[model samples]
Target: MDEMPFCVHDVLNRPLFQRAIVLAGAQGIYREVRWVHILEIIHAAPYVSKHDLILTTGLWLKRSAKSGLEYMRQIIEHQTAGLCIEFGTTVDEIPDQIIDLCDSYDFPLILFRQPVRFEEITQDIHAHIINQHFGLLKKLEQFSQQQQQLILQSTDIPAILRLLQSYSEHQILYLSRIEANTYFPPLPEEMREAINTFCNQQMKHSDQIQEMELWKMDEHRYVLIQPVVCFGQVFSYVGMLLHQAHPTEYMKLLVDYTSKAVATVLLRTQFLEEKILSNQNELIQDILNRSIDSEEQAQMRMGLPSPNGEKYIFVGGIIEFEHNVIEAGPERMESRNQDVLVLIRSLLKRDRMHHVLMMKNNQIYLLCAKARIGKDSESSLYHKIQGLIDGLNKYINQAWPHFHFHIGFGKSRTMLLDAWMSFKEAFQVIELSQTVPAMKQNHYYASIGVYQLLHAVPYPILSDFVQDQLGDLIAYENKHHLHLIDTLAMYFKCMGSKGETAKRLFIHRQTLYNRLDKISDILGEDYFQPQRRHCLEMAMLGYPLIESYHADQ
Candidate 1:
């Protein structure tokens, strides 16, 4: 959809101005000319726009010697395309000062030795501009029609993208969560990976569609990043790589239409897949809802491919999109959940993971089974699950920056009917993710450590326990604005080594001794006795809970 750029050189090529001679500033003949205008005002800066070719018989310059120089300065400063002068009637020959000024600025100056009609020149150049624009619009219409036909012919996402390469004549990069990423006409593996990394970067403001530079391209080129959004969520991206200096309105329209066409194909494909998988989906629902007590029935309902008498090892996990998603509103939240369901299924399918996925209470709940021991090992299964969470979390968080993820994987179970225990463990893991930073790295219940013991305790008792153990020390620090509690923690961290504790606290050993003495007076020296010291350490681990309790108060 590119139209030829009309410039001063093209205008002078016309037969109407055949006798025109270049008087000065011949170097800027290539300057663009969008329209032709007659200069009637002395201060023409306000009326003249860039790309305008000013035409005159030099009457304005004949007003006074000073007026001539001033008028030319306004034309150059306003960046008008050029000036055409007719050496007859009002003014005969031009002043040398004006010609020299035009030459210095490289402002194109043309002169007609014979009288020429300004009307003919304006109409002739204007007709060419109008014709080129009309052709561009017609080409855009044809491209749109072809894409619509491609959608009807096949539901393949790549089929839609192929049109982008053929028509727009640029390398096309289509990144989809639902489909394998494609490079139409294909790029080298390394370049494609580099471009993929470049495109996947999170934009500070994702809603603004713009051009991006392609890394490692020998020639200067750009990639127009256009997102494919459906149901208010972006699930894929379609980008065009070319040498355009900036994103043209034509390029924007082309990418926009192409993205929508791809979206339509993806939506239809998803609908058909959902229809085929509806029964299996219901089986997963029944397992999570505890409506089905028999693993045999679940196997039969989902049509499991496992051999006769073979028991499947099942693992359950919950991927929690924090409670704040509810603030986005109920209907919108529902749509968002459905979109996530699509994303998770796509990701699981991409990793060849055996999973039954669902969105409940704005969180993702899935049960994956190991049907083949050699094909998908336990470690491989965990790797796949972690990859699924990381990929989905990265993608969705980019679209909704405020959204965060907390994931928990349950212990593997021997039967689908007992899979609910695994799910519960996963929920505990999700809870741990909020209070335990170590839990961020450890997603399983087996690695939860002491948090498993504290998980079932009520919030009031936990907070009360922390305060009871450290109450006097906390009170002292608050009253004196001192970090005696920090000193105490560091002292414990250094294992009763006075010098190490002082070094860690950035205080002298005597200062550490003074703080320890104050603690000795406040809580009694037996606070470091084996049994009492253990309680104080656990209280320190639970310190944030009490801090949160105080904040809420």
Candidate 2:
């Protein structure tokens, strides 16, 4: 971070010097230097500016002891960098009294021990300072250009802010103009409120903040605010805080680059955000592919658990749209997909859900975390995930009225190493949900009832198994046009309760008894036996796929 400005300490360390010795006031080494000037005349403070370094031969000091003392005092009063006297030109040695005076004042006094070319020394020193200044400008230029390219390449805003922080090595805080929120190392309540107040007062100009002003909170800490302006108004502001009394020239350049980067991002917000989403989706796929190596790597990729000390439980959600948004041609499908993604993101953001979501294989895969609520009980977690999915379904239904969403979640309280497993399980829940015609929406792997085990069977095998178990009944129903299959499905669903099954079927008890007899005759008298009932339930769960299989054949 550019905490302090260029000082005499920097000049003393330059490679151009022959032998430079500090005589007195070494404590004032931190005194900033604006320019190096040759001051030969006596009482030269009037001509010198603040932080100017005076290089003289001490010929003027040869006049009298009092005059030299007065001249030294003047230099100290004006806050010049220091005195550098070449002894060989006129006076041989610096008087002990003068050195003592400088020491008393804590002023910097330097002695050039050898015969050196003053012209070469002055020019070289100035050139070094200018080069350092230009070097900082070059860095700022490169940073701005790099960030501009990043925007073009669709880097996320938060990632861009992090990159800027890396470049400046300063604490960066981006205040959203719209939300009135802070991002990238978000601050505490008291500090955030104070900063927001300061920014609101400073950013009075709608067009642009006139300059980068260093707002000092104390001797050791300060902030530089640079507004990101668009068109004729300020869209947002970036603050760079450093542990310095004043900011350096280089720090000013950095603040400018930050604001420029922010402006660039704001200008192309849609493209950059979409790009980031697409990239995150790709990252999820890579993680699903088990490409990540460690927890640290996963954290870096995920960027979850907000900076505000938010604890998270990872739950994976799979989105299933009842309507075929994809059948509307590739371009239209892509447009609808983007719209759906936007809707999903908006809803999540509104609810303050921290999530990484992506569309893959015609389903939206989400690894989401809500604030850890109560104990991490499986039921609590499941309900929370269900609630999130339910919210999404509601919003999706509202936005795309014709389309309904069936969302299934996997295990909760999982970490990134186990995220792929959670996603796989959640995806399985969605797939198996097809066989479980009873569970159309908001299903979780652990809560999907009997279908959880049936999910283990391969689809074709499960279809065949269902056919073998229920094929006779299906054939009997088809041949006779009787409502026997429906009656039996309802019978098993009511758990062999004659009264409940009769009530559910809205049939007389005798009619239900007669249907039960017919089902028992076809499947066998052991239909309600424990072992047979288990297979029969599995087959009934797989009935939809079996029917679809026969239809396709």
Candidate 3:
């Protein structure tokens, strides 16, 4: 039911003239003879369609010699398949101008002897066009089969690059991060400068400028740059610098496939690591509960050998009210460790007196100096611990904003089991202090012993009472522009020092005092009074308990 397709070559190859024999009636030179029109002919121009088998004689030729040539030039410009000139017409000779135009334009110009009928060539011309279409379809099918196989069998990145190079005729290809960094391999000086400028400007303005390409780098090379985003983070970039004049449609398809494959590989690897880590975390917790010979023996069982006689335990946790803001995948966690570990180690190194330190999960354990009872060294050690925690908090606040950190430190213990007990107590205090209003803003509360008797009390009784007292203030602070609740919390943390709180908040001293006075007036309590400050601090610490109870209800 489909119509026949047309081809320029098939039309050119059509036999327009019949061979003449004196004896018999003229024999047909081909199975059919069809009329061919030249679009340049004045009368024929209007009737010509895009792919018409145009037919014409030189009837429109003018007296001037230049006219014949200009006529042929016009016909060629129209992209006609071929021109047929009848020798028996008013123009007995084919003009040189016509011949020259046909040659220059690479157009077919066929000559017909007298008495050739154009109608005979139509059927045979249509049949030839159909055959060419079948041939093209077969080639496309073979190519598709080959490409599918290539995609399935390939694993090596270089091998895939080579395959793409051979297929696309492009020489250069590379993967880069969306977050361009100094550690990346150097680029051409000019290109490097441009990219650096672009990155710096983009950081100041917006993060939306994701990817770009450098075109016209050289006559022989074409470039493509694409952004790679993994797990909702812009991770890297994949670039291709091809030594080809231009890219083809197939090359684009290959690039898309390769990018997706790389993402899949990265995702799978992260999942595997997390699966292993989760198992190990459970195993470590089990070991902690069991009675181990010594902390050194525990380390050995955990595949970590202790180097010195001392040990310390640090417990920390990330608090996120909304889990979606936090990235839980293993790859994200590992990436975060790059900056966090540096901060932790830097803090530990600043106190060079501490002998050994080890990081386990969110907690850091250190084997620090021991104090004799008479030396009053416990107070000094407490100060050092407070300083370390404060430094960590400051670093984390600037580097990561969405999450808050809670740190718990335990004193050094001789036995591994004793260290485990200290770590457990510290972790429990961290949990309990979240419920108690009085201890909330206090960084280190030494009143609670290594046993967590406070944590056993139901949080609701304390939480509800505090919430009832502070509910309106909390709601108003959360609703309006000013952050009164955080201000109160920070004020208590700085030991009611207005200047210190102002410095921490990056506000003027007078501004902090004004806000504190306003808070005092609204709550009908003096801001400077120790009793009021203690009550507010306790209320803030008990917020987590209030939140938990509300959630359960």
**Clashing residue pairs in candidate 1 (N, C-alpha, C atoms within 3 angstroms):** none
Q: What lDDT score belongs to each candidate, Candidate 1 first?
A: 0.78, 0.74, 0.52
Largest TM-score belongs to which candidate? 1
lDDT of 3 by residue, 1-553 (tens): 1111243433544454334211111121111212334443564545554445555566666455577666555655555555565557556666666666666666556666574555565555545544554554554355445545655665444444454444444433453322234312345778766545544453444343354544445565455655455655444444555554334334455555555555554455556645654554543455456645555665444343342444433222222121222565655565565345444545655664342344465554443343333445556666666666677667567656765555555544544445455555555555545555554444433555422432544766676657676777887777875878778888878887888899999999888988887788777767447776666666666665566567767
Ranking by TM-score: 1, 2, 3
Q: TM-score for all predictions?
A: 0.68, 0.48, 0.37
Question: Per-residue lDDT for 1-553 in model 1, tens only?
Answer: 3422567888889888788988999988878887899886788888899889999988887688789999999989989999999887578889999999989999999998778888998898889888866876897899889888888888877777887788777788887545566898899999988776666553333444433322333357677767776665666788887664445556667788988897788788878877756666677677767898566777666556752334667789887766454488777677767767787787888887677776668677888877646745677778888888787778687767877677889988767777888899998888667765656766898788777677666888987888899889989998996688888888888889998998888988888888999998887889889899889888876775556446657
Whole-model lDDT, model 2: 0.74
Worst lDDT 10-window in candidate 2: 304-313
- Model 2 lDDT per residue over 1-553, tens place: 5577888788788775548888898988888987889889996867998889889889878898899998988888888888888877787888888989988877889888766677887898788788888887788778877887877787467777887788878778786533455645766789878777766665543335545666676677677777777553455677888886657867777778767777777667656676788778876887789887776567666775442333456777787655464566666666666666765665566556678888865688888765556675445556555555666666556546776556677877546666788888887777656644667653777777666666666778897887888889988988986688788778778888899999988889999888888898999999888888878777877786556546657
Worst 10 residues of 3 by lDDT: 22-31
Superior by TM-score: candidate 1 or candidate 3: 1
Q: Determine the C-alpha RMSD for candidate 2 after optimal superposition of all C-alphas.
A: 18.9
Cα error, residue 405 of model 2, in Å, equals: 3.3
